[model samples]
Target: MKVIFIRHSEPDYSMLDKAQNPQAYVEFGRDLAPLTARGRLLAQEAAQNPLLDEAEVIISSSITRALETAFYMARHRAINLLVEPFFHEWRPDLDGLNYTEVELALAHQTYMVNDGNLPSDSPIRYETGAEVKARFLLALKKYCQYETVAVVTHGMLMRQFVPLDHIDYCQFVTCDIDL
Candidate 1:
């Protein structure tokens, strides 16, 4: 099987600075953030890549940004887009607490140090990196029947499953799956 992973397009983060409560801002942004105009064009351009033309199925995280990117690929290929919550981004904090970008980076570092072992007193309720990998692998197994599958997801999630040095917005990489 072949699995092509596509990162969602650029999100508009300008509104994040204006919110009074950072946690609320993040929660709302997670659900509502849309792509910038350039992001839309990027997605459209990405859809034209020859690799996607062979996609037999397209799946995407339910997040709006991912869905938007998936829409372009699905429309270009004339395939129905399947929504999968399991493909959502990794959440380090379960309480919907506000975490700045710097803090999130630190948390990832901590998680790596712990080998994805959640500390007993961890403030954020999120799947560890190991857990994310396990779930993503399981989801791929369930979809293994497809000859070519395009999965639209977030950068963090893709990193957990594959060795991606960097993933630009609307960028995609194809990997061969033994299954």
Candidate 2:
């Protein structure tokens, strides 16, 4: 069985700068938005990948960006697209203080390096690494039964769910193991 984890393309965060108050920024982070123009183009390019074109089944996070990406691929290849909420982006709330670009970047680094775990001081609901890992591993097991499946999701979820044996972010990757 082969499962492909695809990160959603770029997101437009221009409005993030307008967040004059702390509450607004937190709300902005929580709000789900669609992809930018570049994101759509990137997704289109991703669909063109030979490996993706060969996928027998397509799955995606319920978020609009993932759904949009999945739809683009589904249009090219006749396949039913499945929506998996578990694959949604890891949305952790920041402290009431608005985020500095540096802080936001560091937060992403911590989540990736720490397996989606973050410090207690962080304002996020703070889902544990074990929780994210458990759900992701379970999703992988459930999805990998098929011979070939493509999963479109956010970068954080991709990092969590992608098998460690093969980690390549440059483009689509294939792995033989279920891990």
Candidate 3:
């Protein structure tokens, strides 16, 4: 199976500060955050890249950032777009009071570099690396029928399979697997 994993662009996280309930935003709003103006522009430009020319289908994370990026790419190509929860970002244990933003970033970095094992004292008991890889493979298998499946997802999630130290906004990498 061949998959083109694209990371979504910069999101406008400032919206959280303006939300009626800031605590609610802290708990669940990250997934709902949309892309910034520059992110939209980047997505539009990336949509025209030749890498996406042979894509038979576009699969995306249900999160708004990835979905909007997929929408930009799919609209011009007229390809079918499907949302797969398995493609969503690896989540942090968001017990609003237990973890600090800095700790969240550190934990994610630890997870990515250590292959998903957090320190014994880590506040975020995130999903294991094995779990992440399994779900990502499942999405690939499901879309293997298509000649090419373009996936719009998150950087932390793509790190599980993509061979790169840094995955930038609107960046994409290709991978192949035997079904």
Candidate 4:
């Protein structure tokens, strides 16, 4: 099986500043962030890339940005887009507490540095990197029957499964799997 993982396009963070509550902004932004104009163009360009020409199925995270990114390719290929919540980014704070970007960054860094063994005292309830990898692998197994598949997901989740220092918006990594 051939699986291509595409990260969501650039997000528009302008609305975040206008939010009255930073915590609410962070919570809402996770699912509400839309693509910037350039992001849309990038997605359009990605749709025409030869790499996706052979894709027989398109699956995307339930997040708005990912859905928007996948729309271009799905429409171009005339395939129905499948929405999967399992592909969504890891949520560190289930309590919906307001967390600054700096805090979030530090937490992510710690998570990576510790190999996903978060400190027991940590207040945030999040899936460890290893957990994300396990779930992603499971998702792949579920879709192994397809000859060619395109998955649109978050960069954080992708990093757990693919070796990469960074994943640019709309960028994709392809892997051939033996089912």
Find the 10 residues in a row with the least total lDDT in model 1: 22-31
Q: Per-residue CA lDDT of candidate 1, range 1-179, in tens?
A: 88889999988766655667545655436557778899899999999988887789899998889999999889988997899888888876656666766666777777767766788887655668788877777777878678889999988788775776678998888877675
| lDDT digits (tens) for residues 1-179 of candidate 2 | 77777767666566554557534544335335567888788778777788876688888888777788888777777778888887776654334455555555666667666656766676444445566667766776776557888888766555554545333322465645455
TM-score per candidate: 0.82, 0.71, 0.88, 0.87
- Model 4 misplaced regions, further than 4 Å: 94-98, 120-125
Backbone clash tally (model 1): 2
lDDT of 4 by residue, 18-103 (tens): 77764666654657878899999999888877778778889999888999999988998788789887888877655666567776
- In order, candidate lDDTs are 0.80, 0.66, 0.81, 0.81
In Å, residue 126's CA in model 3 sits off its true spot by 0.8
Q: Residue 85: error of model 2 in Å?
A: 0.7
**Worst-scoring 10-residue span by lDDT in model 2:** 161-170
- Provide the global lDDT of candidate 2 against the true structure: 0.66
Q: For this target, which candidate reaches the highest TM-score against the unseen true structure?
A: 3
TM-score of 3: 0.88
RMSD of each: 2.8, 4.4, 2.2, 2.2
The CA lDDT at 167 in model 1 is: 88
